[model samples]
Target: MDLSETNQTAYRHPWELSRMEILLKELEKLNIRGEVLDIGCGDGYFDKEIIKKFPLITNIWGVDIHAERCVHQGKEHYVNSYNELQKDKKSLILF
Candidate 1:
């Protein structure tokens, strides 16, 4: 039931993931869209839902430690150890 394990593509804790998926589908019905950034996106399971449910999203980015604890194939979103996330006009969605 641990879908968040190893990128098998399921929610980490099971029910928590299921509920979020249902909610995201409902939001899609309202015509909402934008870039999505999944920080600490552990296994990027939620990111998968965002990509499938939200077609309006033009880009998807996720960041996590390069280890088994957080290994997900993302678009290479890495900030230098000294780098800071500067907030500009762009949107930022964190979970």
Candidate 2:
């Protein structure tokens, strides 16, 4: 099924769930630390779950065209563009 047809909530569809699981496993292999940049993040549901599973992650920022749809408040957690994220040059994992 096309992802565009899925529900607004992240990880609701079977494909989404499977993709997230794969991402998590890949992350485990990398043993990543520091921040994360979630491009095209919808409402940050997956970001919340990612943080829970990875204690080493200091922060997770969501960037999406539909920034208003982001549940997270403040620029610290959500931004409309990549340029906004340039303020911080910390190590980041893009997901």
lDDT of each: 0.57, 0.70
lDDT of model number 2: 0.70
* Top-lDDT structure, candidate number: 2
- Predicted structure 1, TM vs. truth: 0.56
Residue-level lDDT tens digits of model 1 in 6-51? 3464325657667777868766676656666666666666677777
RMSD of each: 4.2, 3.1
Candidate 2 lands at a TM-score of 0.72
TM-score of each: 0.56, 0.72
Candidate 1 Cα deviation (angstroms), residue 74: 1.2
